[model samples]
Target chain A: MNHAWNVTRMHLRYNSIWLYMPLIVLFSSFFINLIIAVLSDVPIYTGGVASVYLFMLITGLLTLRNTFSFAIGFSFRRKDYFFGTFLMVAFVSFSTTVLLALLSYVENNLTNAWGNELYFFHLPYLNDGNVVIQACVIFSLMFHLYYLGFSISSVHRRFGRYGMMILLIVSLVAGSLISAIITYFHWWQIIFTKVIAYSAFQLSWGIGLLTIFFILVSYFMLRRATS
Target chain B: MGQILEINGLTKAYKDVTSIYQMSFTLKENKIYGLLGRNGAGKTTLMHMITAQLFPTCGDVKVFGEEPYENTRVLQQICFIKESQAYPEYFQISDVFATAKSIYPNWNDGLANQLTQDFQLPLNRRIKELSRGMLSSVGIVVGLASRAPLTIFDEPYLGLDAVARGIFYDRLIEDYAEYPRTVILSTHLIDEVSQLLEHVLIIERGELLFYEDAESLRSRIYSVSGSSEVVETYMKGKEVIHVEKIGSLVTVTLLGKKEENNKKQAESLGLEYVPISLQKFVVDLTTKSREKVVKGQ
Candidate 1:
């Protein structure tokens, strides 16, 4: 366990750039939104600030691709690497969630959406809840996206580029098949109604479950991967 | 000394290709071992298995009386340096050293700094910007300074000049003597490391070819040159590994210690006997094996 923590610290040191990227993106987007609000007399909506979340997602892929082999070279066990990576991802996600929540609180209460009714950190359905709920939604979404990247990278590591391509193709085909079945059964309307009925907290919790599933699959992939 | 590593029926197969097959050996503590083999001869595969970087298809590898796979207790004592070790793109040499210091329990900061000076490696240079020789020097510094009980170097001097390689060897030998730990040096440049090795393990075509004390192996193989007819007569009933002829002159390498009577006989027969170097002996042996395989096919 100590070794695993050491591996985590190593990852934190080497890949610290990725950890700070979301904050950089958030601040840059905020500045851009502020500039547009000052120039124009209209309300500016900066909902696209979720780009920071996308950056967080990509960080997962880069971490596994770049550091997995290196950790193995240093004689870290596959399990240790996986757990260490999980710890790093969790830490980064939680920190990003808290920062985003704080920014949203400031935007809604302090700056009043940058004094021009901007919606940078505060989205419609995403932040229409208490502070804990807002943080949960962000954390769950970030975790899900990050683990999706992790699962893909784990597949690439274990099976190579060809394997990743095959996986993508298979997933696309399976998705199309499911969509076809849903259309044939005329279930789209029902599915959409059910999805709309679910509250943000419930939906985010479901996505959190998906993140756990991806984490499990990634572990299996990493077990068979070689440096 | 106790055995530091023990292997039994170790094998690693990838699909249809077996990189190592039914190999077994014991490494005693506090001795330098030379793992000598050609490319594709399974030396790297064996090292990876011992370090728990790769799994064996079938076999058991015990380091410090326990399996090394995922066992931090065993792995913490091992430091494996390879030609292709990767560092994070953003890491400078100093970052790498700091990370190594944290992971390895016995890492020596003073020794690492001393080696950085000896190898003239810049601490602030990003890993991606360093030249290949400098990268190799970084590995050497880490391997020596980590001071792990079992240190393995697999072709660790790629792109290094002769001077840098000499510094590596000198530092390795000096630190190893003071620390008294097991070291495995695997390289294609066999002659350069021959003097540093106490025991030698030779692998050929996924099989163990020979494992013995280096001195014993040196005495076991020798070459003789003379007239074709005389050399042929003298080499009869001996285990001849290689034979070459230029016009009427013939040279043959045989496996056996040179007895006094055999030398006397060769002298009387106008044959000149020469001791074969380890590098030449390995090359000749591997060449002969390859030829035999081609002929068999």
Candidate 2:
């Protein structure tokens, strides 16, 4: 357990990737949206904020490739690496989500989208309900996307390229099969109606459960991964 | 001294190939061992198993008398610097040093800094930007400075020039003298590292061929050259690994530590005893075994 912190510290050494780039990408996207919204006559309700969330998912995948093989061969137990990476990702997810939540509050309540009426952060369904629930929505979504990428990369690491290729084919086949079944039954209307009716707080709980599932899977896959 | 490592009947097999097969050996504490073998002789596979980076398909490895797979007590004490050591794309040499300081319990920053200067490594350069030799220098620095109980270097100086390699050897000998610990160096450059090696382990075709002190291994074989008839007579009933003939002169490389009668017999027959080098001995040993395989097939 004590050595696990060492592993976490090691991962944190790449601050440029984990901390600086994400912030840079987020703010860059915001400025671009802000400029276009200020010039337009009508109010802007663009989804530019999704770019930052997309980058967060990429971080989860990049972290494994950049660090997993290196650390495992450096005399660190696989469990130590898993725990350390978990702590680092969890901390980053929570803090980044909180920041996003604060930005949403300011855009909605304080500055009214910086007076340009640019609706980037406080989207309709995502920013629903009270402040605490609003933060949970972003946190849960960010956590889930991050771990989803993480779990996929772990599968790649534990298994070789052939295993990863086979897994990807299987996942594509299964995904298409499920969508075909849903379309045949016209379940999209039924599913979205039930899903859209749920409050932001309830949806956060569902995404949070999926986040936990991915974290558990990544742990097991990484525990047995070799250098 | 106590046992530092023990392997019993270890084997590793892939779909259609076996990297290591039924190999076994024991290493004592505080000694330098040379893991010498040809390129595909399973030297790296054996080292990977010792460091717990790869699983043994048929046997077990005990480092300090405990399994190293996820055992921090054992893992933390073993530092393996492989030929293909990977680093993060964005990591600088300084970052590697900092991380090494955190992971290795016995890490010596002073030695690390000195080696950094000795090897002339650019601390701020990204590892990916460095040349191949510079990258190898990084591995050498970390391997020496980490000072783990069991430090294994598997061809750590792949692209390093002779001068840089000399620095590595000098620093290794100096640090090892002050701090006694187990070191296993795996490389095909037997001639360069032969003098520094105390014990030797030879692997060929996924099996252990020889495990003995360096002195005995050196004297284990010698050659005799003279008239073809006299040399042929001298080689009778002896273990001859290789034989060559040029004109009327015949040379036979035999296996037996410089025995008294062996040299006396050569002298009486007007034959000369030619001392073979460690590198030549290994080449002959492995090539002989390979020829055996080819003939068998």
Candidate 3:
């Protein structure tokens, strides 16, 4: 009877189209690649799963813009709304992660890339870890990207168009400034060395922390947002 | 009936404009309140403050005797439907109703179904694809069927035709009588909804002008017109609320004791009595306040 759960239901009802689309796109691309791999007799390595992660990001960006106002009109508490959105996205990420893990297993061992050497689901570095670790890495990556989008969306919700504009300009300036400084100081070598030293499992723990940060920041901003 | 809502010294100020000035009012349970005001008079701002959607610059708002902001216990018992209520872009009318059904604990599926038919809405159609009037009907259906203990509708019938508006009023009254609740309706069609309102709250330029029973509001004002000189003479030592002059033919509304003999006295003095309606009174009041603001500036 918690209205937070009701908010999750509300989101789930409208999310069907966006929900299944990434999977559909992934599978379609997989089959098409399978056809090409069979004909050419060449090893096919692809980033087809990238579409699934990017789609989650888009869903996060749309979450508040589409539903927050409507839910508030229906008398939902802000906290409940955020809680529901959180639950819904978490459910989506977990499902996506599980499916990717299963497909990766099939490509690696079960069918040997569907008998045609098509490495669509199993990327080398990403799947280097054990099955549990690989699933964790994928889940962390998808969940983190979704929350990153949600956090950005919440800024607009709380602060309006000007807020988004200011954020964009600031991000661009900061990104350029950081890139310039890093190049001038020749820091890329050190950064790359440290980054490459960490295993994918280790990297996912960092992503897990960043995902929590995005979730918290989004909730704080959306708390004061109006319809 | 207990007090369903109580607001004290509420105000919302933006960087340059004050949306609602210091305002205070207590609303009793199970009465339909008419939140009457001209456009930009802060009626919507006040309602948003009451529902805890918009934070006030300063004041207290208690719904069901508790602070409403972020309070689930208080929020779940309230339903707020507005003219520009948003829906998910991909939603159909049926999808909207399904979400509403899940959100509202007191939701009436039978009434929702009946209203969907009464409004002649194609539930399968995407909400964005519906006509403006159909969208209004969707809000009306949800507001009526929610049956929340405290329901607020801010201009709930925009773009609706006369027949559809009549159906709204009829359904509102019928549903309200069957299941009594505190309803606050803000609208510009004052005359149409005058009879439905038990109490009237008039806001002028972010300030509370009138907060009283409907009958008292009607009985407290009467209008008369004559030449500028005679009307001025009659207005001496009298509390006047509104006046209009057309080439020295003067009309003035007096705010004083309601009396049967006042009309007779006006006629005897060669002044024409203009029957004042609730709508006229509200319009005259807001116009007069606008003049006051203009003069002050």
Candidate 4:
């Protein structure tokens, strides 16, 4: 069997949970969207569509963190692992985006007719007939997450759970302190806030860029592991 | 005998603690070698190094005169059956067989299915869902069916009942007779596999203590028992492996072959002779006097 295909088949068969993850994210968004729709007395069309990206971001974070363990956990070649993961995440993220977009279209029409109701409209992440490329982009995005997860997990296997939590707390505390100092200083508050927000945005974009670099690093670790 | 695998001062260390010392040995083709060692004696570590699952801290290992690491040509010909094989959680028995068929060039599906039926392993159940014994059966099945040139079984009888283990032994011997490949059996059950092993390698404290043919291994040491004076007289000028004294009666293990008239001489001198079983010989060889030497030097 082709090693990549074998690995991909194994992933699909054993880990259908990854494919269904988007649904979990979608549904979570749905409930949150429903709550906002009811409270604000507005149609679920726009809010629900925007929520898809939020769902993608959340799912992407989780998907990135665990990508490495599942990718190269066994005796499969490291390259095959990377490719197999790339294929699986790409298929999943793109499928979710399309489904959400179709759902949003239905939502927009329903809202116009019924004043305030939960329905779907085209999500912002969808591209016109470029599903393949879109999926690849999503895959690259998640692959970055996988690299981060694998690197951190390698340094400390226990890092995924409590280590991540501790990291989260520390980052939060640092950000809050920094934010407070900027607010008190007042001189550069506007500039500081924009820089902070841009940095966060850049951080998200940087994940995809760093994923390529990490893939090579991950290969090195994998080579070490096999030996 | 032509050596299929050779080790030259191989050592593997984890941080400060050394798991395997600068050990060296040669494994010949088409022979069954017993790797006899107690727990924490570096048996698994040595096997892992040979199979390229680990890197040696120093020294070298050659399989078929080539390095085994990531060399698919060499790897495809070797099978290392871990004591407790780990399978993907959702992979069924069939998946493992299929994966083995794909990875190993010589994998025989027919042999795999046969072993699966003989072991009564279910094909549909996920690996994780199977019982411990069933998991062990799966490992054995893969090891056998792969039909690799150099097959290493490391404590493969862990969760198997005695009957299943007996079946494994019988099948192994039967298959081995027909196939004639190199087999390395690493197990604690010395008595059970004593007959199957043609050669034995006894290790102690990460060091190779003895490596010799099993048939002649017994001739290297002989036990003599009689009155303390008689036994001591018989053992004079000979290498004495062990000596036990019970009142006037004494038993002495001497390192030498018994002559045709040696038994008659013992009888004439009021001494008794007993043949040492392979298990007793290995136990005495691996354990006795080695700990003190290791501690001191």
TM-score of 3: 0.97
Q: What is the TM-score of chain A in candidate 2?
A: 0.94
DockQ of all candidate complexes: 0.75, 0.84, 0.81, 0.24
RMSD of 3: 1.6
Candidate 4 lDDT, tens digit per residue, B1-297? Answer: 678899999999876788899999899999999999888889998988898777799999999889987665676788888874556555788877777676677788888888999999989988879888998898899889888899999998788999999989988988889888899999989889988999999887899977888887766656789888778788777767777788888887666654545566667888887777777766666556565677888
Model 3: per-residue Cα lDDT at residue B254: 82
RMSD of each: 1.5, 1.5, 1.6, 5.2
Give me the runs in candidate 3 sitting further than 4 Å from their true place: none
Estimate the overall C-alpha local distance difference test score of candidate 2.
0.88
Using lDDT, rank the candidates from best to worst: 3, 2, 1, 4
Candidate numbers, best DockQ first, in rank order? 2, 3, 1, 4
Give the per-residue Cα lDDT of candidate 1 at A125. 80
Better of 1 and 3 by TM-score: 1
TM-score of 2: 0.97
* Candidate 3 C-alpha lDDT tens digits along B27-83: 999999999999999988888888888999998999999999998788878888899
Report the error of model 2 at residue A74, Å: 0.7
Candidate 2: give the clashing pairs.
none
lDDT string, candidate 1, B1-297, tens digits = 899999999999988888999998899999999999899998898998998888899999999999998888888889999998988888899988887887778999999999999989899999999999999999999999999999999999999989999999999988998988899999988989999999999899899998999998888778889989889889878889999989998999878754545566677888998888999999999999899999999
**Predicted structure with the largest DockQ when compared to the true one:** 2
Name the runs in model 4 displaced over 4 angstroms. A21-40, A43-140, A157-205, B257-268, B290-297
Q: Clash totals for all models, in order?
A: 0, 0, 0, 8
Look at candidate 4 and tell me the lDDT of residue A11: 60
Candidate 1 steric clashes = 0
